[model samples]
Target: MSAHPEAARASSSTPQGKPRKAAFAAWIGSVLEYYDFFIYGSAAALIFPKVFFSPDDPATATLISLATFGVAYAARPVGALFLGHFGDRLGRRKIMVWTLVLMGVSTFLIGCLPTYAQVGTLAPVLLVLMRVLQGLSAAGEQASANAMTLEHAPENRRGYYTSFTLNGTQAGQILATLAFIPVAALPDEQLYSWGWRIPFLLSVVAAVAGYLIRRNLDETPVFQQASADQDVARMPLVELVRNHWADVLRVVAAALIATASTIFSVWALTYATSDAVGLSKSGMLWASGCANAVALLAIPLWARLSDRIGRKPVFLTGALGCAVMIYVYLWAISTGSYPLVFATGLLFFGVVYSAANGIWPSFYGEMFPARVRLSGMAVGTQIGFAFAGFAVTFAARIAGPDGDNWKGVATFTAVFCVICAIAVATGRETHKVPTAELGLRPAKEPAKPQISESVSS
Candidate 1:
């Protein structure tokens, strides 16, 4: 008989292996990494301008704080090329473990750093370095985890299974936001002096949990099978570029859907709570925590829907929904309508954006063959996410001096949203793409069977 493709695959991807267990571990691991990541975004938006830098020039201080947040993103594309190769070469588990370690160390050290007043120029300089390290580690974390989970998943259920990754991300965002509830409530003296550090220091627990969970996960079946068969590409980056360039471009463009994540989680949080806006700090954070809380459920629902109807329709619906709602969400923030803020945030981040965010794990992975899945996804996503990381600084610059023209921010975000919609709209529908037919493999029948007749005949 011919080789059993499924039988040759080692690790947790086989029918008999613990696919669910592996996915669960990936979920928890990713959740922890994102918790560390979102905290920097949260701090940059709300606290860094006040505490990390010299506040003597308010405008320069804000710009510098925002620049620190962008530092990590600057390192991400570079990190992606290296770590993506590692994941595609060494397997996903190793990359996941390394990411958790890098993020944890940086966050803990950040908690211990001296502010600008105490350390002068060294404070911001060190902060930028830590953020760069974090960006590098993060560039690989989600892409590798998504590929691992997708490879282990049952062919028919890839979308449903991989949705857990983003669900974990929402859980992380929720935890990070919850961590700040107490910190944001502290007095100004405490907030600037030490309360901010409290959230950063809690990285210890998250790192420990991520380490323990990720260490136990088996390498993905696809990667294991490649190694056993000695079919692993000599250079995954070159292989991906040579054969999968179009798909890489498609994935990059489609990944613009992530704009929804940054716009809601980072931009909206800052705009609503800034002293210029009059909304309380805790109020905005709760809005974020609550919206993602709802997203925890909505993300899975959208993925399940994609598993049924198709990835494109659901994704397009989400893109359009968030585009229109950004207008309303921004308006609510400008007016200080707490009810409007919560309602619109929940509707946009929790429901609309979740549709796109949750579905993309499967959607993007499906575009590449296993030989270059990590390389393709990592490169595509990080390059696309560059816009998101930069959007915070750009949005602030775009904000009118009066800071009331959030309509300008909405317009900027909407143009990007429309671009994302058009890009994804052009891609092939993956909900019906058979497991074996996805990526570089054209559609074909299952390998033919061989049988022998017994003497009884």
Candidate 2:
């Protein structure tokens, strides 16, 4: 089918967008949103097992705590459906503000919850509820930010502009890790009693900063033009399903690449610190922090390369590279070598995996037209991210009784990376496609008329 004519016309007539401003808003907003989201992850790995769950069975508590981390992923798709609709209909700015506030409030509340020692079953129950709220807020956060940035970006640099969102995410992860490093170093009594709560409470600062930036930010020209022309989809989810189902499916499959992240950030942290490996929590946290620090620099460079070449090659490179690197990283952790752990962690996540991480914002956003862009990206990516969220729980199960079966966990994560690579391999290349023409199928050429043999004779 052809591109939306109204959208194409609007693109031509609209004034130049504030691409840098939009990218900055996306970057800072994501930094805050994911900061709230990832602190839960850090706590789930290092603290929640002891505080929220029963101490009777350390094994079961660890398993359940990791499962709670996935609980947010389970809630994300539902949040995406609701938030994506409003983002497409009401405007990306509104949804962005709403998500930030919701995430901040929920995260802060998580810090206040009483632990199992204080409230028994109610403690974990409340934690799960808060995690679900975080999931809902995150559901719309990235998709809306990506759509806003992509529409605002210059035609030739969508990849570069949209990459800032993921860059912000890496920064947030770094921030979360850094926050936890000191907390993780506390004496066990102090650490479990009050230290972990500090990171969750700190989310308030991020919320305020994010709100200040996003409130003053201007809406994207493409969205404004669509609204002006009455080209906004009344039911973006329905429109996305009817016209863009294949792309949605492709996104869902490709997003499994996040499994690598879950394994790295959550499961690997748990494994390294477990009795079998006996690595220090602070040391592992430092390794992750350093890896994310490298990613902060690597993500933008890889994104610029995608803008110059195309999204597919860079994305595929990362996905395929991750499939191989997962083994090496897991091996490093199993060997009890901190230096090897840091080196492989940096190579796997910071450098190789970042190619896919940096490019997906643009690559996924460009798969649908402006009318359904928010909904399509939100729903597709969230569904896939759900699996990535639960992957830590699954990885724990597969890693044998000792939870030190690095090979088994590596094999499981590698399988998903391969699946993600295959999914992206089937997608349309959109880096070179004009911003207006994005998500539209190309026009087919007419067949030439055949000459009759009799007439020729």
Candidate 3:
């Protein structure tokens, strides 16, 4: 066991000035990348079943359309392995740039794709291809952004600094919902034909803005020091598996928390709009947007609290609270009570879910040293997130043909949250640990190097 370069940098302390800048840059990049990713979820729920799928057997069409959204998740683990390796070895700055470009191009192409009416079987095939690219881009974006922030952050403030990446995620969801509201409000013909494409097209602007923001920032000092010391891992995945497999497994289980998100955003939206519930698509979109808007504020607050109290307690509070609150929220939607729907949505998604969502970036990244941090978090979280990506399909099946099984969806969501909480509980409390000491094996005194007699000769 040798000393890691990040440990030496931590002993001296990284410069404090750029952590804020790095956090802001990470925040902006996430907003852009996730905006590209989430807008597809909005469309898959609201527009794609009608526009891209067969009209016969409406229930099956909707399931297939939603399944296309999950196709991206299938690609994520592969992208994580490929991109995370480069992120750990080559540098975070380059990976961030490439992922953003890939997301932007994929999203923009999705907008340009012809529908089932226009292109027959070719339409959905093209749709799935673009979605795979979006998934690939997303696989690396958050992990790399988080690793950059964690490396730059002052030791005591890691939670607060890393929270910005997730705040940006909330912001992106808000933007995606807002973009969909007017389009979702359109007549069925216009919405399916053209209005829905507008949000995907808007991704270009986010791409340009995010690229400019990330391009000028310097690489994190931890990475710079690792490079200077010639200590960069040749194969980060190999090293990570050998030394940090338990942390990766913990991160995978904890990352299943994303299941709650997709269910709320995708499945719940579809369920509310079904004839059984009769909630307006625009209304549900507004509820989601408002929840995410509130989350943008709540994420940083929860993260600051994690910094003070440690990660697991705040995270468990969130995980368990969401378990209870999602039931109330979905039940409210089932009852057709708009006020109750909005209120519960805000509480569950905005407040409770933010507790876990905001903290995981810091908590997971801190489980590895700089040499393997990006690869470890990326591979672990992406594989877990793949489960979340398909949660909508599972919820659709559990709800049956009429889509009225709010209780089943709620039970599914709550169970996922419980598992996530248990996973978080099993990990070490890292808030009080020095940044340099995190993920370190127990220390042993190094034997003094023996002088060779040949050197004296």
Best by TM-score: 2
Every model's TM-score = 0.92, 0.96, 0.95
After superposing candidate 2, which stretches have Cα over 4 Å from the reference? 1-8, 443-457
lDDT of 3 by residue, 1-457 (tens): 2255546555575444379999998999989899999999999988898888888867888999999999999899999999999999999999988899889989999999999999887999999999999999999999999998998898889999999999998899898999999998888888888999999998888778878888898898888877877879999999999999999998998998999899999999999999999999999999999999999999999999999999999999988898898789899999998999999999999999999999999899988888899999999999999998999999999998889988998999899899999999999998877766678775656799998768543
lDDT of 2 by residue, 360-385 (tens): 99999999988889999999999999
- Using TM-score as the yardstick, the better of models 1 and 3 is 3
lDDT of 1: 0.83
Per-model tally of clashing residue pairs = 0, 0, 0
Best by lDDT: 2
CA lDDT, every prediction?
Answer: 0.83, 0.92, 0.90
Better of 1 and 2 by TM-score: 2
What does candidate 1 score on TM? 0.92
Q: Give the total clashing residue pairs for model 1.
A: 0
Worst 10 residues of 1 by lDDT: 1-10
